[model samples]
Target: MDNQKRTMNTDAVISIRDLRISFGEYHVLRGVDLDLYQGENLVVLGRSGTGKSVLIKILVGLLKADAGTISAFGQRVDTMSKKELDDLRLKIGFSFQNSALYDSMTVRENLEFPLVRNARNLSRGDIDRAVEEALENVGLSQTINQMPSELSGGQRKRIGIARTLILKPDVMLYDEPTAGLDPITCIDINNLINEVKERYNTSSIVITHDLTCAKAVGDRVAMLFDGQFQRVGTFDEVFDTDDERVQQFYHYNFVE
Candidate 1:
């Protein structure tokens, strides 16, 4: 439960302080503070609409924060220009909840998209090698030519991860990685997440409501509620908390 025991490195890869966001009049994240260290998986545990997705979007520079500072790898994210943010994104991999693979593209093409867009200087051989390595990392090299439509939900998710891996990101963001999969497939994806982290030595933020995924992938868990992180610690530490709001999340009593 102790953060010192949970984290492998004291170096913070991502630092967010008093982060706040809103949509017109409805506030989403009020004032959230979080620090993700190198080589650690920090799980954000929150009910639906608690701004878990928004926080990561801000981290990746996809969304603008109305207040507070976001620092990634010691660079100020809030002030980064579009070009600078694009370069930053190359080091941060995001696996979306819906898999977000190109339905029309084959597995290989989906994996090649990032390289083609960002790694423009890579030779044909280099791109091919990158794709092969990423697929092998996800245990899907044999499915290289298969279309997204041909794969199962879990396989599609793996492909999404492979696509992210092709870029060799330093930080990984998984948004509901196991959502919509069967229990068995969920477990498979969970294991794959662990494998990727160990293989790449990447720091990550896994946003999910599934406690099983949290316990399996998280070095520390933070419960997001009422536009802020109410509590943060190891899975058991947060699970055992007496805070009523955290207990509501623990018991699946989400506010509607």
Candidate 2:
């Protein structure tokens, strides 16, 4: 956000400082600084190639940053041990762009996968109750026995979210949560994002290029431009700027 070194926000669930990453000659993230606070949804707004997804990857340890300090829930992500990182991941839920469901597994089976693997000590009854609660939260209890192929686009998205929420994570990372959905379905997913925060009390970062999704779920919107977050504010405040890069982003979303 600035040339000067900034102190990390201790209260923030996630704190990133002067983050930089590059591939070959293509620099994906120049120097990103951000904070995701407790119980708040921070939306990272950008186009398809502006490193929005890359930022999420860095947060969850899928990708490493070339330079920067990343702290997740008081733990420095850049220097964590393998075992520590795995434990941290369990507390941070990530909903992928595609539903990422196992086509062979039923909805119930999909939800049980993570719980059974990570929380191996849970009994049969515990697993069943967790699956049922997650489905109910997403209002998809009836789809418990159905396969992923049988679900509509929206239903698959809900089930994807159910699988993520089954862990009761402390933080959530949503990668294009409303992508590939109709207008009504997009709105449904937006409402579900908010409901997830309320019910789970989880700090979240929602990555999207969709203006409607950003407006609906974000408490604060950070616009990514040229590998850096040029503007960070509420939905209206970010779009109200006179910066051309910011204006171009808003225009693109408007036309899309």
Candidate 3:
């Protein structure tokens, strides 16, 4: 494979080069390179424990890479200070795999938390409007007064997305958006991922092992294997090859 396609380019909303991390003797990511272009959904495909989730954490400075270059919005994430990282993170929205909603807070309060804490000097009206708009975007406006426990699995996921959307981040990072959901719910989340890009014009990196989610949401796909991206292309392009590793992924396309 020619290296230029995966190498960092100026137009990429997020670019990573030679990203490597390890746990004592076990190297999780040997040397990973990826580029997320503007307004494009780049799916990072890998089996569980391949470090897909770790890569996402590294992007947001939740975890540090042993060695690599991570650039988001033209800023070097690996070199950023705490203040700088915090500033950069405000522009990136991360939707966790399990939809990490606060059980103690109502849907409205959960949505308001980020804005109230991050955005200053906002009157009660501003927060209320933002919360309402976000809930509406995810088609969960009616659940505003409800608790996280009261919502279904899919509804909670939508609310998670809504909370992220409320911040109006320029980039979205979704970690297994379709994990642990029914087929119909997965389709809805897939549709929502596409809808988000169109509606917000935000570039995204969706990390998942689910091939169905990849084909539906990814403008391009990159497969992480053996601690590196061994395949990078479209849904068909990546899996069309006869490589046993890639074929194995295609054969087990459904979410577990």
Candidate 4:
């Protein structure tokens, strides 16, 4: 097969078609179709009021779509049984924009909680090993015993990532991973994301308003506007397409 056909033939880990979501009278997403390829980092960008966060929630089954097909990891999610959703979640992980760490638990325990809850067959030693490996992956082995309150924002975010990593999820969704971090820390996190992708072959869907972060980590970029995807393409293709809305957003946010 030619490169274009080969690209098209590769099955997507996450696929949505004609997805429509509404909150009573307000439409949040409209006929949105998206496909995320294996190990591809696709970034969804949009203005604040757009449904970026809602998109994240839907992909992870936190929110149900009003209409459409939602499939992830070869399973149709739109009508999955509760038991199936639980099984599917074992193969997918979501890191919220807010770290959402449990303040009462130590970082190690926070990471351990999911593993213990989901992988009931795992012994205590196996769970500890997994937690240690996750912490090591995030470069936070030293902070395993520390509380979320004792860590900085960036550290807490890493801990959240560690928690997600402990699940060994096949697809990872990151909502605004770079938000509220200093420039250096943002770069650090971006590099860490790249490292994780390279090491684990983790497919990712990242939603963010951070153009710099998007450009740094995205394999392809999709813009959500007016309850639909305005454009979807490689970073260069979409950013340089000369589309008025994209140009406006780029210039308004990125012009120095």
Q: Best lDDT goes to which candidate?
A: 2
Write out the backbone clash pairs for model 2.
Answer: none
lDDT of 4 by residue, 20-57 (tens): 89998999898788899998999999999789889878
RMSD per candidate (Å) reads 4.2, 1.4, 2.0, 3.5
Candidate 1, 1-256: lDDT as tens digits:
3444333222689988878999989899997888999899999989888899999998998889999888888888899999999999999999999989998899999999989999788999999999999999888899999999999889999999999988889999999998889889989999999998999999999999988899889999998989988889998888786787677666773333
**Per-residue error at 210 for model 3, in Å?**
1.1
Task: List candidate 3 stretches off by more than 4 Å.
Answer: 1-7, 254-256
Off by over 4 Å in 4: 1-10
Per-model clash counts, in order, read 0, 0, 0, 0
lDDT of 3 by residue, 83-125 (tens): 9999998899999998999989999999999999999899999
Q: What value does the lDDT take at residue 208 in candidate 1?
A: 94
* Ten residues in sequence with the least summed lDDT for candidate 1: 1-10
Task: Give the winner by TM-score: 2 or 4.
Answer: 2
How would you encode candidate 2's per-residue C-alpha lDDT over 209-231 as one tens digit per residue?
Answer: 89989999999999888899888
lDDT against the true structure, per candidate, is 0.89, 0.92, 0.91, 0.87
Q: State how far residue 145 of model 2 sits from its true place (Å).
A: 1.4
Rank order by lDDT, top first? 2, 3, 1, 4
TM-score of each: 0.92, 0.96, 0.95, 0.94
